[model samples]
Target: MIRNTILLAAGAAALFLSGCGEPRAYGKVDKTPYEIRECNKELYRGIDTDPEKHIDKIVVHKKKRELAMYKKGKLIYACKVSLGKNGDKGDKVQAGDYRTPEGSYRIVRKKCDPRLYKSLMISYPNAEDKARARANGVKPGGYITIHGQPKWNADGHADRFTLAHDWTEGCMAVSNKAIDALWIAVKNGVKIDIYP
Candidate 1:
């Protein structure tokens, strides 16, 4: 009888302790939520802005670390992205601030860097950005781009070490292979909407 009573007390204490502890999920956890699609031959081909189902808009969810491409208001492609190291807080204000701006912008230019991979220059510091900076008495930073990993070894070879985290001054970064697909998929003047 004493042993049974002791066992009951211990069981109750364990239940109480477990209830006081942090709640935990008791199911299978999906570690990789993002899906990376295969880069087909069309992605490797030269830039063709006049495809039948072209992606006209790009949306970025900073908190989710996702970039989705839309074709006529439909989501066609999506990939994981890394923003500026300080991008989690808010919009970029000044030069060298290391925060990705939150706003609607366009791909003003397409730059091909042999070492840094392809880059789609974003038109940051729009009128609102300038106004906000002026109000804060800061210089509005420029030269924000959506780029790929560094060409540490060769042209097509990218250093995985550099692409592992958010480490840009004020740019959005993706994989080198992802940039190669985006380079052909998107063109100049496409709208890119960035959200916090």
Candidate 2:
């Protein structure tokens, strides 16, 4: 009887360890068909809309859901933002962990997508992120970005309901209209600071 009890305990321990071994994957990329629309120039009439306005910094307050733009140490614009679904807990630590990273990063790349609206690549899993993941014996995921909503259907319509929620895997999300402005306002190599 003692031998059987020991075997059962060993099996339970193995199950528990396996459960704790890896992070679960979250979020899905939408691939529905979409088309770009010509934005109304009048939509961005007020304030300084010039790319030369010298806006060079982005600060994201994850808990507060705020994204503020700065130019030469002055506030240029501010808007609401949505972070990863699991972002409230802490900075992302491994692949498949649905938490946005917190730290200083740069806009490494930019790509225009009809389905996803627009995307600004963030340099996640930097040296420090990699180090943390290495220490934990896990892979640090990549492909993090600041992007707009996806086209949900063939009509090129965006799901406004989804846009109003925090649902990304590990990226910053903004409205398509807001991304339009950001696309022109933000330049590559601009510094982005994400705070918890």
* Candidate No. with top lDDT: 2
In candidate 1, where is summed lDDT lowest over 10 consecutive residues?
A: 31-40
- Flag clash pairs in model 2: none
The deviation in Å at residue 52 for candidate 1 is 3.9
What would the per-residue lDDT of candidate 2 be over residues 146-191, giving only the tens digit for each residue? Answer: 8776544223233344445566777887777677678778767889
Clashing pairs in 1: none
RMSD of 1: 16.0
Cα deviation at 194, candidate 1, in Å, is 0.2
Q: Assess each prediction's global lDDT (C-alpha) against the native.
A: 0.68, 0.69
Sequence-dependent TM-score of model 1: 0.70
What TM-score quantifies how close candidate 2 is to the native fold? 0.71
The clash numbers for all candidates, in the given order, read 0, 0
Model 1 C-alpha lDDT per residue in residues 1-196, reported as the tens digit of each score? 9997875566444322321011245464332111111222323454334465457999999989888888888888788787776878788888877789999999887665433446788888899999999999999988888887643322333334344456677788887667666776787789999999
